[model samples]
Target: MDPLVLGGIVAISTILVLFSGVSVGLGLLIVSTGFLLVFDGLRSLELLPEILFGKLDNFALLSIPMFIIMGASIASTRAGADLYEALERWLTRVPGGLVISNLGACALFAAMSGSSPATCAAIGKMGIPEMRKRGYPDGVAAGSIAAGGTLGILIPPSVTMIVYGIATETSIGRLFLAGVFPGLLLVSLFMAWSLYSTWKYGDRALLASTTYTWKQKFEILPRVLPFLAIIVGVLYAMYGGIATPSETAAVGALLCLLIAMIIYKLWNPKDLWLVLRDSTKESVMILFIIAAAGVFSYMLSSLYITQSIAEWIATLDVNRWVLMGAVNVFLLIAGFFLPPVAVILMAAPILLPIITTAGFDPIWFAVILTINMEIGLISPPVGLNLYVINGIAPDISLKTILKGSLPFVACMVIAILLLCVFPGIATWLPDAVMGQAL
Candidate 1:
């Protein structure tokens, strides 16, 4: 049997299982097990324990749970509202400022939490109502929050980036550095759209209805400043080589949890339990997927499929840019179904060799991949952020949320093109800060 044929069948089967509503981790395991039995016989099972256990016994992976804990603690509190309100108070005077503020808050909070759903839920709860009350179009208001939330995976300390680093053996800290500029670039593009939307409807007055005095704005800062400081501290620790990813994540999670407890009076056992429970659940899901993907990758390699595919791609006569365009298209399609972490774990190993072979930096490709997944968070049929925002604003139809998010999706696409033309947007900061990725 042709290895490529088997690879194609495996890919299709995995997608079908996911579409049938199987969870990514489990769906992957089922496909992997089925193939190992059919193709490699039962004796291939001996390889499982080593690959799965070895894949997860890393110190760096510890950061995933800590980051999840940090994000969960913040999400289970009022930091989301406080962050949104603080920015709203400051940006209220500008036209379309309310929506712009939400985008800014999402960017800032994403830096802290590193989970798209958490970012969407936390900010969308407050931002949606306020925007709707102020007569911002429902689609636009809901869309802005949903779109802003996708920044979570593209920002530092991101679970997705960590997964990518682990899967591809790239530098986690350098990948985090790589994400910084692209993250900011997306935020700027989103904000630019918000500003344009306001100007397009200038007569309608897209400004926030609420107003705050300088004293009021200053007062809100004290509550939000600590979280902001955590963001700065985590970035500093990682980029300055002051701490390992695990160290910053652990300390940052503890600090975030304590601060949320003290400031929000959320130290009660239930809230604490909720954060811990949620963190454990999400972290376990990710770690399990990592283990499962390791098996799936091994099967592909053992079958000579990955090597064959990479060889086939290398033999293509098309321009590398054309190859990238096709890769982006394929990734965008995959993102529509799978979570970013799952996508990274399953696909990064397969694609990284091909990307580097084409004379592209793996770090720059990570940013592009992250952005594609960002678009998936809002794309219809299965976009998670779309549902998160819909949960917050149940009155807004899914179609409306998708509608509003379209422009921001275009913003992400534009960011990708910019990166292609000038790869430095993703590579420069990492190179400067980390001395070029090896």
Candidate 2:
């Protein structure tokens, strides 16, 4: 088969496998292997071992498990819950206070967990009950938690940023710094939206007036200081050039382990075992996807499909913004049903070249892609955030979750436009920090 024909077949196979409810890792492997055999004969299949091993050999990739361990430790220890309560108390005087606090808590949790599901799960458990008890509407409560949970990808130390940086060979520390401003921008947007919504609909009454003495308020600080300290410590280490991103992750993991074991006393034998087990499982799944995607990508290149597509794209005499708009639309549609990781792996190889060819910065483009994927987490039908929130709030139907998410999804759309129009939102921090370093 010709390269273009092989690419076409692989693409179709991948879509079919996903639509058939097969696992993404297995689906990509099957499609890639099938293409290899059809195009290059059985001998090509022998490279699978080397391919898989090479993917795992990456030192940068080691950060995935370390981050997962830190996140799992925080989750199991209930530290996120404590931080949410602290934030709630601090922000409760404002309108839509619970929702605002929820977003704040999620942001803080995002810095710790570097994951959407864990952030959602941690905050949802505490936020939902508090909101419901305070008479907040079910839709609003669920929506806020869902929206806030998506923060895990936007904030610093984000697992998605790490993954993207690794895949593209971008500076991970720079990517982390690059995300800070945009992530905070999204958080601010969410807060503004939540306040407006609450004011329009009328907020629930404040919880019982229990005045905490200054001493009592100060007591809550001890619980949350670790979460904040880790963020500062890692960024400082990276900024000082004392540690690479991977090495920083190892240090972060060690600190988390000690905190769980000594400070929190949450790291019993069973808990440690569970964290290790879960981290290993999640890491394997991620590695499998990366390897399979790598193989499929190699197959596409061998087939010359990317070149043909690039040539066709080059022929179009359209404005750069129009071309970018089209790519965003493609990602948004794909996000409705596909995982962000899959979309990134498959689409980046194709769209990235077009973006560079159109004179856009890859650093900014990566941020744009990150925003698009974050939106995907909340989009309906197959939204991972929706399923996560639904799993936590079982009484709420998927319809309710989707309905609640629509407004925030709108907010995300607006956020994307803001980033597009103002690329500095993504680039400024990286430039400032890296400039100082130089």
Candidate 3:
């Protein structure tokens, strides 16, 4: 059989299994095994262990589990709720204050968690009720949390960035640094949209000032500030060359556990067991997907399908901007149908070389890809964040939620344009930080 035919079979089978509701890891593994049998007979079996083990054995990958542990432990301890509450107290004075605070809390939590669903879950559990209580529309409240949650992968320490960095051989630390400005930019833009929504509704979301004295405001800081401090300290030390990314993650996890024990008092033996168990489960699921993706990626390379696709893309005579716009549209449409990990796994291999050959910045493209995935977090059918938020806000209608999310989606479109116009916003931090190290 032709290798391209074998490649197409493998890709189609994987998607079929996924569409049949099999776990992504199982789907990829089964599909890859089927392809290996048909395409190369039993010889492909010899290649499996090396590729799978090689993919899973990276030291940098250890950071994934540690970060998951940190996020779970923090959520389990309920420290994130305190952070949201404090932000609410401060921001509730603004028109559409609940929406603004939801976005703000999502940004802060995203900085710490770096997983979109986790961000939505963490903030949604707290922000939903608070927003609903403040007379905010249920759909608007749900939409804000869901949209804001996507900030997780756009921000630093993001799991998506780490995966992309590993796949592309880009510096993970530099990728983390590169995400900072764009993440904040998205947050600001989301907040602006929320304010605009309030204005359109004639400030219906405006909450009367319920006085919280300065002393009272100061008192709530003790509950949530330590988690914030851990993230800030870890990033600062990493930027200052005081620690490697993995080391910083380990230290941050340890510090977060300690804070949970001391401040939240929720890190007892049982709680610790649960946190570790949950972390292990989440880590295994993600690593399995990565391993399977690696195999799929390997098969693509072996079949020369990636090269063929890249060569085909190179034949297009379009300029860089047009190429980028085309890429963006493709990703956005695919994102509506695909989970983020799957999207990255499949598209990254096909798109990477094409963009590089066109003299485009891969780091900026990574950010652009992430922004497109951010849009997917709110899009229909398989939007993980939308489902997570829906589960949290059971009372909200899907139509209302989708309507409320439209403005933030528009904001993401604008944000993508800004990144396109000034690729340096994504590239500058990585270059400056890495250059200084040199």
Candidate achieving the largest lDDT: 1
In terms of lDDT, model 2 sits at 0.82
Decoy 3 TM-score against native: 0.95
Between prediction 2 and prediction 3, the one with superior lDDT is: 3
Name model 1 segments beyond 4 Å from true. 203-208
TM-score of each: 0.98, 0.95, 0.95
RMSD of each: 1.2, 2.0, 1.9
lDDT, candidate 1, 183-239, per-residue tens: 999999999999888777662534437678889989999999999899899888877
Residue 372 C-alpha lDDT in model 3: 96
Report, for every candidate in turn, its global Cα lDDT versus the true structure: 0.89, 0.82, 0.83
Tens digit per residue, CA lDDT, model 2, 278-356: 8889878787778777776766666687777776788899998999999999888888888777777778677777888
Q: Which stretches of candidate 3 lie over 4 Å from their true place?
A: 1-8, 207-209, 436-438
Worst 10 residues of 3 by lDDT: 202-211
